[model samples]
Target chain A: MRVLCCVKRVPAPGAKINITADGQDVDTAHLGFAMSPHEECAVEEAVQLCERFDGEATVLTLGPPEAEEQLRYAASLGVQKAVLLSTDGSSWDPQRTASAIASAIETLEAADGPFDLILFGNESADSGGYQVGIRAAHALGRPIVNAIKGIEPDLDAGTATAKREIDGGFELYNLPMPAVMGVKEGLNLPRYPTMRGRLASKKIEVSVMQAEADEGGQTRVTLKQPAETVSNTVKLGNGPEAAPAIVDLFEELGLL
Target chain B: MADILVLAETEDGAVVPATLEALTAARQLDGDVHVLLCGDSVDADDAAERLGEYGASTVHVGESDLLNVFGPEAWGQALALAIEEISPDVVLASGTSKGNEVLAMAAARLDLPFVANCTELPSELADDDEVELTRVQWGGSLLEQSQLSAETRIVSIAHHALEAESAGGSAAATETIDMEIDDLYARTQVVGREMAEAGVTLATAPIVFGGGRAVGSAEAFAPLEECASLMGGRVGCSRAVTNNGWRPHRDQVGQTGTRIAPELYVASGISGAIQHWVGAMASKQILAINTDPEANMVVKADYFVEGDLHQVIPAVAEEIKKRKA
Candidate 1:
């Protein structure tokens, strides 16, 4: 089995994000970056699946050149290869990103072999669009599942069972091969890179693909800052006295 | 005449709350409301009755063997087929994981413009129908309004963004439509299903007890669990807590995990990042407990306690116990 896990480098979840002074996009100069938390599970699942199924795991990313840092990180986690769709970091629209990723996957298939499985995080931690994986699956004409919490791959039967999170709990699903699966967090705890693994990863080569515009550049009418609500700060005591005040506050807020 | 198509999500043979909310929003339009139901032997009589009550004049049932196991491609194809059959003016679905995925593919395959997590309706509907929509941006701190041009409007409504209300009426007449099953395309099969750890879902919990990096360790989260249990609620965590392996990802409350709308949300040791706030901001009352007087959570909180979580949590738990006693 050949597994392809799509990874994205996003701003760290805890960072206080601010739109640049230009008011067009997020200010990235001071923000730290890492693999999207959900995508980490995808990469981890891909590595585990390959380990169990006796196959190779290839990590793919579509972003600016800095995204290569995440690809290298995936390599450090024992991913056999890394593919980067390096763009100029301007167009991060979901549809355009999906199209570019689909093209990159097609190129890889033409060079290597058809991938048996593709994995993606449910959504990017930064943009949280939650559309690219399914759109890519559609563009590639493949089956897909989103927000999968658990996966059971059956190599002999050439089918996979996935448990997806629904409104309440989850529903069981079975899908066939050459499918796309979007992994949510808690699917598996991603492993940290070992010293030996990191040394080996430093020697791995990364393939960078040229950027191309998606079908017809999807129009981005305007990018503006969202409205901010005023912060209402209230302080309370730490003991039993706080409870009534809390209740009174809830009553005032119409929460009780 | 233009018709709006709403995809009604069903779980375990029951219609989901968000689906009703979507149908309610769909009724605001001046076109016929058409609903699509997919499942293995969906009780069309019951579903159509509910859809009709929610203002759907026509319920289109797409029955397939593959419906038992959700095949995104197959479902998208089925929906695309339904769209062709109905020629809808708009296609709407709840922004649940599955709803967003299937509709995105359906929109992409049809080459139609699409938007996600829409909080408000577009200001205008014209030939181009470039609708302006509000979506949570900058980690829920800001709502960005943008426009999209498409002949057929496609959008996914953010769950909990709208309230769910029943439309009082008898069940509409049932109609069954046999959808073509592409077993070849449906290569994936569901082998089985397993439940997550037993607890009230954070999204629906009335009171959410949450922790952050300040909790220190997984063991320290025991107090939160106790508080949640005492309140008959559920426990939630910020991304930092989950990242540190202090809690399972399912318990994470944020943009990437599960957006929650609780009556009272209590944050312990959390510094309130924008993404985290965006998820829980819908809560009616927010209480933040942290030693840091200037924590972002303290600033946003309705009630702030400037004390160590280690001290505040046990004290609060004891107080709840005393109150119950």
Candidate 2:
């Protein structure tokens, strides 16, 4: 099985996210970068699938040179190959990003055969457009599903079974091979890279290809931090003393 | 007035509350609201009647075997066809998983632009081809003022961004659309479903008791469970707790887990990282119990109690039981 997983580099924000003075980007001076949480799980899933099927797992990202860091991180997690769809480090709209990634996939598939499966984060941690994977799948003429938390690919049968999480339970879907899925975070518990794996990842040569696509109709005017939720926090009491007050407040809210 | 189309979703043969929220948002755009209700799971006639009361002037019902179950491509194709027939200036849907998926598919099929999780739209959106709007980023931690330059604007209203209220309008006229289902539409049809045991879910519970890593071990969640059970609520956890294997992912309250809107969220020992904050921000009230006074949850919550949850939670649970007696 040949699987490709798409990842994005986003700031790993802690308590709060601060914007740049221009409001065009996030302030990264004191921040660390990590792969989007869902895509990290996708990478883990692809690696496990390859391990089970004895195949290759490739990780790709569409971002600037710094995004190579994310691709290398994927390599450390057992991805055998890495590709960088190099961009100018500017944010692209969902349509443009999808178009560029689809084109990149086409170029890569031309060299090697088509990937049996392609996985993407259900949504990016930052922009959260919720469309890039679907649009890219449409462009590749592949069937796609979103919010998938489980996948079982049958190579001999050329089919893949996927499970999507709903409010109370899950819905299962079956798709032909060469399918796509927007995976959610709980697909798997991502494994941390071993010391040996990290050393090996440094030697994995990332293929950098310049991304080409026209800007889509959606444009970002600026970014603004949401107004902080103003709360006149009422301190009820300390320790066990707070319990009676909590019950009283619960009664006030009609929870009793 | 501009012609606006809303893709309505249904559950248990009635309109979903989020769709009504979308309709309320649509009314703000100053348009004649038309609804597209598709699927056998929904009673199209009943949905039309309810949607009409929400200011929907027309309801276009489409039914097909492929649409009997949730299939993204089928719904997307149906929406694309409906758009062609209605020729609306704007299209809206609830920012649900299915809602966003279908709209994305439709946008791809038609090669148009679509935006998701919009919290606000400019009042002059109907008149302008290129309009600026505010949408949530980082799961509502940040907001983006975006520009959409599309002939037919397609967007989804953020969940719970607007209250769902009826406009008390006239009954809507019904129109039926022929859903042309093809073999490809069934490629990803939902073939099986598994339901969780009936109880208050984290997303729907009136009160949620959330524990963090400070709860220590898996066994430490017992008091939280007891409190939730006594209060007729549900127990949730932060990502840290889930990552530590103290709870399941389904019980996690955070950006990647579940976004809840409980009336009261009792956050115990959770520090309220941006990821967890986004999920719990919609709660009507929050009571934070933590040892640190400067903890994010404590600072942001409506009420705070400074203490170790180990002692505080059991006491709270005991108090609830005493009150019941």
Candidate 3:
């Protein structure tokens, strides 16, 4: 019943993002990085599952050396071990990320045993690709569920019932063991690290895996910032009179 | 000619608006557009006629009793069958929760490149006929343009980002296909659904009045809800408000909750986080009512009213009543 949770480092929510001067990627000079919000939920879910099932939880992340901070944070949340697949600040698209994660999982399985469950946030709050979980499942040839809002494990039958949020409501599914799930927020409120936990997390070892070219060259093009529209301010009457003025404002912005 | 396939999402046997929008985009590719509808014994004639109005030249109907419940694996298998039949150049789906899951699995089964929440379409086809796309970044505050090298491009359109246009002609053609429902896979079933008791869904509400941490307490949200109802709308809340237990999770409007496309979005006491902005940015008009003149939403909004929600919301509601009279 061992579980693995994949986490990513991203710009903190609400951070004002700026494009680099070359227009190739986000400007990181003034940005503050933290664990992706949804990934925090994934880590929390993994920790809770391990606590309930009497197994170990391992946290994984693929980024530069700095990403070790996120892994350490997961360790503070009762994760037994941390694995960092370090890259040279290269953007590994979903496929490459999935391959690296699958490779690491295979290596870990060789040492210990296979993980019973793998958890991930629905998508990175930064890239918002929303493809890694499915790609990883494909690469590993396992059952996968995305944007799952709830899960009830049936340990006797070796199956899990999951509730996935749909457009207006939710859909239910039954999947066998050794499946991957991309969790959405509100699954649980992630716990904050205690003083003792923070002190112990600093002693945990982080193993860094070297990236292979084939598994690191998936990103085809770098991202560039979009053209910015100038901000304008207007004030109309508070009630019905404001409706026409709002329409006029939209028309002025060419959004009408 | 390379053709595109669109998985038209439907509920209660009717095509969703986002599906029509996807078809509208597909028609611009200058290739045959096929629409796939999977449901419980759906009428192919009626479904195909509606799909044809959205520029779907060919409508593939896959019906089975198993479709009474939405199973990703079963839907994935059904879509795999359709893809095997059409071998489309590209597959398009909406970025809704169900659409995202089904398409992700379908793309993986076919070993093709996949992208989600695309805001813009490819300007021109590549030499290999691969289509590039532009998608939002940083929680919709920015846009990123990129190209996929795969022959089969899988993309999901951002909901409400595109307009649904009528196909402007008679029904083109229709075909009925039989799909198998494996009883074994039916092990998982949705016994029932408990609809949210909220009067109006956040996504469809014409006016969304949202509360944030500044609202102070759960009891304070009643006035905001009253104001929303007075405006013929519904109530929404920021993540902070939901985190504080002032509102239900379903009422939270943000990246983690529901992305809304309303006619008017009123931010009451909300400071406007990027995640929150992503959900409400597509609203037709934004009105930020915050005491802080420098609130982030004030900058992005079409109009800013500098006042406390406690004072402003009541006044606005009263004015609406008076104006109507």
Candidate 4:
């Protein structure tokens, strides 16, 4: 089984997100970078699947050159190969991103074999378009589902069982090999990179390929912050003394 | 006027509240609101009546064996065919998990651009070839204004962004359509389900007792659990709690976790980071209990108590118990 995972490098936002002066991008001066939480789980799941199934897992990313850091991070987590679909630090529309990623997958498959399974984050943390995986699945002519939290591959049967979380339970889907999935966070707790793994990650070779695709129809005009509503909190009391006031308020609200 | 079509989501034979919200959004475009209902389990006549009250002028029902079970491709194919037959200027749906998935599938099939989780749409979108729209990003913490250029504009209204108001109109006329669902679409259909114990879940709970990193450890959540149970609610945790392994990720409340809308959310020891704040902002009322008087959660909450949750939660629970006795 050959597994492939796609990841995106996003700003590691703390407390609040600051916008650049041009309003075209997130201000990166004071922020760090990391993959979305969902993508981190996807990378972990891919590595785990390969480890169990006796195969290699390749990590691919469509991002700027700095995204090599993310690819190397995947490497530190036991991913066997790293490929960077280099961009020019501009955000690509979901459609264009999917197209470029599908092209890159095809190029990679031509050299090796087809990936038995491919994974994507449910949606990017920043844009949250929620369509790239679906579009890419369509382009690849493979069945796909989003918001998957659990996966079990039956190598002998050449099938995979996926679990999606709903309000009150789980929805299970079975897909044939060569399927794609848009996995969410909580699929697994990703492992931390060890010191030895960090040194190994630096030695891993990263294949850089240009992301060439036409712009999609949806174009960004600007980014704006929602107006914050400053709350006038009524301080009930302090410590245990506040407990009675809290209960009274709850009673007033009819929660009693 | 823009002719708008809304994809109605139904549950247990009735239209979901979010779909009504979508209908409300559609009416804002100053167009005749048409709806598409797909599912054999849905009571089309009853759903049409409810949707009509929300300003749906027509309800197009598509029922097929393929749609009897949830399949994104089959539903998307039905929606794509409906768009072709109806020739509406714009298509709309609630920004739900399934709603966005099916619409993205339909958009992919039609090779058109789709904008999901839109908070605002231009009134004159039908008259223009390209128009600017505002969409929710970062799970509602930020908004992105974008220009959408497409022959048929497709969008989904962000959940809870607008109120579901009744227009008090007559019932919509129902028309059944031939849903030509491909057998291949069944490959991706839901095969089975493992239902959780039915009760007050985190999403539907009226009261949510939320704990953050300050809760210390997993065992420390016992106080919160007892309080939530006493209040007939559920216990939720912040992303930090889950990340620290003090709680399961399913119990997390944040942009990456569950987006909860409760009558009251008691957030304890939470700093109210942007990611977490967006998810909790929908609560009707918030009471923050943190040691830091200037914590983000405390400042933004409707009520605050400057104290440790360890002492305050137990004290609150004891007060409720004594009152009950």
Q: Candidate 3, which segments miss by more than 4 Å at Cα? A: A13-15, A213-220, A227-231, A236-256, B39-41, B63-68, B176-192, B229-232, B314-325
Q: How many residue pairs clash in each candidate?
A: 10, 0, 0, 0
DockQ of each: 0.46, 0.83, 0.35, 0.83
Which regions of candidate 1 are displaced past 4 Å?
A13-15, A238-256, B39-41, B68-70, B126-129, B137-139, B142-145, B165-176, B185-191, B196-199
lDDT of 4 by residue, B1-325 (tens): 6789999876556678999899888888878789999877687778878889999999998878898778778888889999998989999999998889989999988989999999966786755769898998888878999899998999888888889999998889999997888888888888999998889889889999999989999999998999898989989998888878888888889898998989899999999997788878989999999999888889899999999999999999999999888
| Candidate 2 global CA lDDT score | 0.91
Chain A agreement with the truth for model 4, given as TM-score = 0.98
- Model 1 compared with the native: what TM-score? 0.91
Best candidate (score: DockQ): 2
Comparison by DockQ, 3 against 4, better one: 4
lDDT of 3 by residue, B194-273 (tens): 35555567888877888888999999888777767766678998988876667777788988888898877888888888
Q: What is the C-alpha RMSD of each candidate to the true structure, in Å?
A: 3.0, 1.3, 4.1, 1.3
lDDT of 2 by residue, B139-196 (tens): 9999999999998899998988888999998678998887887768799888898788
Cα lDDT tens digits, model 4, A41-138, are 99999999998989999999999999999999999999989999999988899889999999999999999989999999998899999999999989
- Tell me the TM-score of candidate 1's A chain: 0.88
Q: In angstroms, how far off is B261's CA in candidate 1?
A: 2.0
Which of 2 and 3 is ahead in TM-score? 2
CAPRI grade of model 2: high
Quote the lDDT for A155 in model 3: 79
Runs of candidate 2 exceeding 4 Å displacement: none
How does each model score on TM-score?
0.91, 0.98, 0.89, 0.98
